[model samples]
Target: MALWILCLLVVLGMGFNMVSGQGEDPFGPEGGRRREMVPAMFIFGDSLIDNGNNNDLPSFAKANYFPYGIDFNGGPTGRFSNGYTMVDEIAELLGLPLIPAYSEASGDQVLHGVNYASAAAGILDITGRNFVGRIPFDQQIRNFQNTLDQITDNLGAVDAAQALARCIFFVGMGSNDYLNNYLMPNYPTRNQYNGQQYADLLVQQYTQQLKTLYNLGARKFVLAGLGRMGCIPSILAQSTAGSCSEEVNQLVLPFNANVKAMLNSLNVNLPGARFIYIEIAHLFEDLIANSKIYGFSVVNRACCGIGRNRGQITCLPFQTPCENRDQYVFWDAFHPTEKVNIIMARKAFNGDTSIVYPMNIEQLANIDIEPN
Candidate 1:
């Protein structure tokens, strides 16, 4: 028997917000529901999926800083994108409300789960732009551990254990490590290591970090590999005469492939640990190859700034934004629009064992499993 459940969360952004049960939104009853699902979700990763762990961190991508959350909760929460991320969508699809920011760590946020992801974080200790002062994935793990301890202090250990097992732990970062270490030549970390060596260190760090989360009582996880970072407008600007850069793709493909291999190896060695890969290769490539199919009209250009270093230097208070943000694939050079994240989340949530690996988030949540 298939046990599935679905949840809905309706966030109202400016013009892009879609009514529930219809239109472009992923969680609002448009996609079929799941039954007996995980009660909550937690996320850890970069800008592509952060839900404002950068709230207290000092950085430019800080979503909790200002008009950022003008739409959602009336204050910025450091989410980076326009609105919503894979974590938000999945939480909605699981029949739960949006998991509160980890800093909002009340038993209230713990009702479903809490988001521990910081925008500049990576799988290793050395990722993210220097000007941006990254919160390394290991340090983020420390925050998660503290969050657990706080929960234990309040909810006790058994509840915390159940929370760890029944909730979907989403990991969607690590791109910045490569980006800062290899792509952007100006960083000190890049000058310190060759591409081959840095990539090797990155994978090793990712392996150990995932292990750390497991040791902390996280049982189910969704690991999203790097997508086509080469195709982003920022990279394209730096390419041969403003064209799509194949060199960036070179870095992405091998890194993502290795991530898959690492996950497989982890499954073989770690008992009771379940995981799924988000297939970022196909997802981003599909968006690039067929933009309209993904409902994006301007796939190559950013909806935010004037291009080039728009991924970083833009998002100013004076720059003009596009009229129809829903049609665009990107909000900034590096981050996807809310619409794009919704689709990605839908793809992730709807994935079965065949696509995601061992068990879907639903099953991993222990919503329905064969008796032991």
Candidate 2:
């Protein structure tokens, strides 16, 4: 019965892609004129999208060793995947080069953008204390403010604001606020509030942080919602039968719901703010359910990890990973493979309203903001 359901989902997915013209290559024709969709792309979040930001941080959450980034151009560049991250693909689709990490970005590089995401970072400042040295969301904002100051120093306040107004502020946060803090045994968050209350608390803080970005000159926003956290290798490994923890899955819905509502409210309240929500959870669930159609043969295990489902421990240094990395959905206990990232990024870039609510990244980029 489950097999039949999965087959049905694949059929539906294929048909939807065909109708939506999503099957076409997004990189454009060879030697074609490549036009940038936005002036710059400022990124924030945790390891799922962190390129090399956490490499220098004294944190256990770091992934600067072998078996990580095995498929990328520069091997082991602190990405928690075998190859490209979602944002990397998004940058390519937008006709821009890869956005450098804030720690490494310098000189004229700041004109394109910087990624401030850190491994184990979360919406709450104290959420990733277990990792030590992880930069929380608030601190990431401050880092961006510093970047903005440098840009303003070079371009002057009015010109900097004009350039920033045309940039894309891509934020994908809150996963660790659950995986590392609320759900961890050492944390007291679980006992402090119920699921709904915890979600409300996170979004409330999130709203202020985003508004701070807006006040600092961000006008176009692409807010990525959390994926199916319970289905990740780490959470699945916790089950005796290697099944997804439905309880963990249920815990995050309130957060996604509150985030969607918050983005909608921000759109109407904040002038010139065009905030869109990426249905990441929905897209991930689809990919997992219809794995075969998407060319993923292993949906439950990591390509490079230890123990049952290769999930008991994350990928280690110099470990031999599965050769057929493209067939796996995950590269580690918690992060998706480059293949999955590519699919997700492409969808968010050009997918219809069902995947990216209010508007897609392409639409958001094309929106012209009146100078203030």
TM-score of each: 0.81, 0.90
Taking the tens digit of each residue's C-alpha lDDT, what string does model 1 give over 245-311? 7777776676777788888888778777777787876777777788877777888777776656455
Candidate 1 CA-lDDT value: 0.65
lDDT of 2 by residue, 1-372 (tens): 121121111111111112243333222344363766665688999999998888888889888888898899989898999999999999888877788888887544544567899999999999889889898999999987764565355445665566667778899999999999999999988999999999999999999999999998788999999988998999889888999999999999999999999998998999888999999998998898899999999999999889888899989899999999999999999999999999999999999998999999999888988546
Best by TM-score: 2
CA RMSD (A), model 1: 7.9
lDDT of 2 at 78: 87
Off by over 4 Å in 1: 1-36, 64-76, 150-159, 191-193, 307-312, 352-355, 366-372
Candidate 2 segments whose C-alpha is farther than 4 A from its true place: 1-33
